[model samples]
Every structure is written in C-alpha cells, then in structure tokens.
Target: MPELPEVETTRRGIAPHVDAARVTELIVREHRLRWPIPPELAEHVTDQPLLALERRAKYLLFRFPAGTLIVHLGMSGTLRALTEAFPPEKHDHVDIVFDNGRRLRFRDPRRFGAVLWQNGNPLTHPLLAALGPEPLSDDFSADHLAAQLARRQSAVKQVIMDNHIVVGVGNIYASESLFRARVDPRRAAASLSRIEIENLTKSVKETLADAIAQGGSTLRDFVDSDGREGYFLLQCYAYGREGEPCRVCGTTIQQIRQGQRATYFCPSCQH
Candidate 1:
C-alpha cells in the first residue's frame, strides 16, 4: 500500500507538469476501479485547467474551479507524467492528457484505487470530512494525541494508527515510529506518560518526514512517479528484522502478531 510519503512524492513529481495545464482530453481505458471511476468524469474535466494538485492523507486532489478530482491509490497504484509517445503498460487504467501533449497516467493492477468527482468543498466531502489532522501539520502535537488517548484502552500502536486520532500513520510507519520511540507496540495507550508520548510524537514526525524525503519505502508495489523504487527499506531498524540482532542493543529483534499484523521490536531496547 502506498502511504502518505509515497502519495506526497507522487504529488510532487507530477505537479510541475500537470498543474496549470489545460485538460485536452481524459481517456478511461478501464472504468472498473475500486469505486467505478465516476461515469461523467471525462466529460466534466475536459476543457478545465488543473488549478492545483494537493494531497490529503492518502488521496490526491486535482483542484479546478468547478470542483476537485479526488484520487486514492489503494493498494497498488502508480501515477506518472508522460509525453504522448510514452507507451502504456498492461494495467494503465486512465490518462488525463493536456494540451501540451503531456499526460498523467494512472496504473492500478488490483483496481482498488478510485477517481471521483467532487462538486463542492473537498474537505467537507464525506470521505474526508472526519479525517484527523495531517500528521505533518502543526496541529498534530504531542498534547493533541495525548488528549485523544487519555481514556483509550486500545494498544498504543493501534490508537496512533487510528485515522481519527492522526491520519497517515499506516502499519509500516506505526511499527517504525514505535521502534524509534522505544515504545512497545502492545503498550496500553492510556498508560503512556507525558515524556513517552512526546517522544512518540517526535519519532512519528521524523520517521514520516524522512520517508517522504526518501521517496517512501518500496516494500511491495510502491514506486515514485518516475518508476524508481524507494531506498528507505535499506535503513529499517526492526520492522522486518525479526530474529536479527538489534541495531542499538545486542538483543535479537522479535516479531509478534498483534491484531493479525506482524509487529517487530527489540526485546531489550524497546520496553
């Protein structure tokens, strides 16, 4: 699954080419996506200029005067900016061609991705209305999360992973952030002290920012808009290093199943 960093990377990569460009045509090779690409999508955005391209959580918003085009990459999707002569691959589902002969291509093999139209304020849309503060936003502070978790009995990892508490803390990032903060994944959310919560917050921010800079980790099908795999996987500490020697301590890292997800931690280093 492409997380926040990967989506942000895609936004940055295609923004320069697509933003402010006038849409000449929209080609839907396959409309049967996760949500069945909005039927009137092609007709709606035909001659409109792309006002802006921004990312909210895991979805990308292509803003125009009338409305916004919302895109979610689901589990395995890639967006690429290409020239007219660029060859389309097997799974290329849609394309937004500009007047300049450039196109933004969307490829998703699993078809779990979506392309929807919004005629009103995108933030107020039901899909995005209740989402929590962006993890990178100034509003997502330690105090903010601490207050949200004060009475929650859920595991600290699960609490942070909750979209209502803070958006974009996916499974990969949750494990990495907890490992960096030296917090056990199974620790109760309400049991955290102020200091521990502060450390966890900082670790989450740093981990996400670093991953974004690195173009996101390519553990599976994730890739940058340019089709290059991310290099951050080479620097993972404990996420998938089960039974391996801990990077900080000499103890062997252990793996456990929590909520049916594999969690990795150092027995001696992470309390």
Candidate 2:
C-alpha cells in the first residue's frame, strides 16, 4: 500500500500539471474499487477548475469549486500524469483529462484504491473526518504521542502505527522510526519514558521527512506520479534487511512478525 510519503510524493509530482486546470473529463473504466466510484463523479467535476491539490494522510485531495475529489492509491495503485491519451492497459482504471490535453491516469492492479466525490467540507467526509494529525504537523508532538500511548498495553511499534494515534506511520516507517529512536519494537507502549517519547517523536518526523525527501520506499512496484521508483528502501536501517548486518552496529538485523506485518530491528542498537 502507498504510505504517507508515497502519497505526498504523488501529490507534489502531479500538482504542477493539474492545479488550477479545468477538468475536461473524468473517465472511469472500472467503478469497483475499495469503494464504488460515485456514478456522478464526472458530472460533478467536469468543467470545474481544480483550485488546489493537497494530501491528507494517504489520500490525495483534488480541490475544485464544486467539491473535492478524494483519491487513495491502494496496494499496487499509482496515479501518473500523461501528456497524451495513452491507450488504457489492463489495470488502467481511471483518467482525469485536463483542458490542456494533459491526463492524470490511475492504475490499480488490486482494485483496492478509490476515487470518491465529496461536497461541502471534504474533511468531514467519513473517510477523512476521524483521521489523526499528520505526523509532520506541529499537532503531532511528543506530548501528543505520550498522551495517546499512555497505559496502552500494545507494543510500541503497533501503537505508533495506529491511525487514530498519529496518521501515516505505516509498517515500514514505524519500524524505521523505532530503530532510529533505539526503542525495541516489542516493548510495551506504556513502558516508554518521557525522554523515550521525545526521541520517538523526533524519529517519526525525521524518518518520514527523509522518506518524503527520498521519494518514498518502493516496495512491490510503487512509483511516483512521474513513474520514478523510490530508492529509500535502499537506505533503510531495518525494514527488509532481515539477517543483514545492522548499518549502525554490525549486529545482524532481525525480523519478527507483529500484527501479521513484518517488524525489523537491531538487537544491540534498539533496547
């Protein structure tokens, strides 16, 4: 699945071509996604100039006068800008064609992505209304994380990965952040001290900022809107480095399963 950094990367990569451009078309080759594509999405957005392009969590918000179009690049999904109308391939699902002959195409092999229309305040939409603060925002400070993690018996790794605690800290980022903070993934969330929380908060921000800067980790065919593969995985300290020497301490990086997702950490470096 595309994480926050990958989604943000897509938003930044495509905004230059689509922002303020009038929608000439909204083509949906397949309506069966994580949610059904609203049948009237084209009628609702056609002719409206996109006011802005923003990202909330992993969803891309296409702002327009009438409303907003919410797009989620699910597992194996990608949105790319095309200068011309390339013939749709097997997984090519939707297209947002612009008046300038440019096109924004969506392809999802797993059909778990979404394109939904929302009127009024898009933030109030069910899919978004309850989301936690962005990890990069000031609202997600150490105090905030400490309050949320208080008395929670779950592992610190799983707690940080919770969407309600802080948005967009997915599996890869959670592991990397914990590794950076030198916190053991299996440690109880409530066992963390203030200093540990401070370090963890900083690590989350730094890891995510670094991932966004590096274009995000390309796991299983992920690419930016411009079709560029992210190489952040190559720089990872723990994720997918199982049995490899730790970059920081030369101890073999270990991988364990948490909540059915892979968790990687350094035994000597992380307590």
Candidate 3:
C-alpha cells in the first residue's frame, strides 16, 4: 500500500496539472472498490474547477467549488498524470480528465481503493473524521505523543502505527523509526521516558522526511505520480534486514511479527 510519503509525492506530482483546472470528465471503470465509487461522482464533479489539492493521511483530497474528491490508494492502487491517450491496462479503474487534456489516472489491481465525492467539509467526512493528526503537522509533537502514550500498554511500535495516535506511521516507517530511536519494538508505550518519547518523535519526523525526499520506499508497486520508483529502500537501516549486519552495531538484524506485520530491528542497537 502507498504510505504517507508516496501519497504526498503523488499529490505534489499531479497538483500542477490538475489544480485550478476544470474537470471536463470523470470516468469510472471500476466502481466496486473498498467503498463504491459514488454513483453521482461523475455528475457531481463534471464541470467544477479543482481549486487545490491536498492529502490527509493516505487519502488525496481534490478541492473544488462544489465539494472535494476523496481518493484512497488502497493496497495496490496508483495514480498517474498522463499527457496523452495510452491504452488502459487491465486494472486502470478511473480517470479524471482535465479540460487541458491532462488526465489523472487511477489504477488498482486489487480494486480496494476508493474514489468518492463529497460536499461540504471533507475533514468531517466519515472516513476522515476520526483520523489522528497528520504526522508531518505541528499538531503531532512529542508532547502530544507522550500524552497519548502515557498509560497505553501497547507496544511503542504498535502505538505509533495506530491511526488513532498519529496518522501515516505505517509498518516500514515504524520499524525504521523505532530502530533509529533505539527503542525495542516490543517495549510498552507507557514505559517510555520523556527523553525516549522525544527521541522517538524526532526519529519519526526525520524518517518520514527522508522517505518523502527519496520519493518514498517502493515496497511492491509504489511509484511517484511521475511513474518512478522511490529510492528510499536502498537507505533502509533495519527494515527487511533479518540476519543481516546492523548498520549501527555489528550484530545481525532480526525480524519479528507484531500485529501481523513484519517488524525489523537491531537487537544490539535497539534496547
């Protein structure tokens, strides 16, 4: 699945082509996604000018005069900006063609992504209303994290990964951040000291900024809207390095499963 960095990269890539451009058409090739593509999506967004583009967590928000177009790049979904007509591949699900002939194409092999239309405040949308603060925003601070994790018995990794605590700290980033912070993935969130919490918070920000700078890690099918693979995978320290030498310490790295997701760490480096 595309995480925060990948999604943010996509938003930046497609913004110039679509922002302030009128939506001449909205095409839905597959309406049966994680949520049905709103039946009236095409009708609703047809002639509206896209005022701006923004991303919340993993969802893409295309602002318009009427409402916002909410897009979730689910498990195998990707979005691209196309300048010319290319043959749609097998899973090419939707296209928002601009009046200028640019199209924002969405492809999802698993059909788990969604393209929904909403009127009024998008932040209040059901899918977005309950989401936690954006990880890259000022609202997500060490003080905020410490307050949330004060008495939680969940693992520190798990707590950070929880959308309720803070959005966009996915599996890969979580493991990398925890390793950088020298915090064991299995450590209780409540057991963390103020210094540890501050370190963890800084690690999270730096890890994500690096990933975004590298255009995000290409796990499986992730690519920027420009259709380029992210280079961050080559910079990983502990993720996917089971039995490999740790970058910080000479000890071999290890991998374990926490909440069904692979967790990697350096036993000697992470306490």
lDDT of each: 0.90, 0.95, 0.92
Where does the lowest 10-residue lDDT sum fall in candidate 3? 18-27
The estimated TM-scores of all candidates read: 0.97, 0.99, 0.98
Location of the lowest summed lDDT over 10 successive residues in candidate 1: 81-90
Q: Which regions of candidate 3 fall more than 4 Å away from where they truly are?
A: none
Flag the better candidate by lDDT, 1 or 3. Answer: 3
Pull out the clashing pairs in model 3. none
Q: Which digits, one per residue and each the tens of the lDDT, describe model 3 over residues 167-221? A: 9999999999998899999999999999999999999999999999999988898
The TM-score obtained by model 2 is 0.99
| lDDT ranking of the models | 2, 3, 1
Model 3 clashing-pair count: 0
Ranking by TM-score: 2, 3, 1
Runs of candidate 1 with Cα error greater than 4 angstroms are none
Clash pairs, model 1 backbone: none
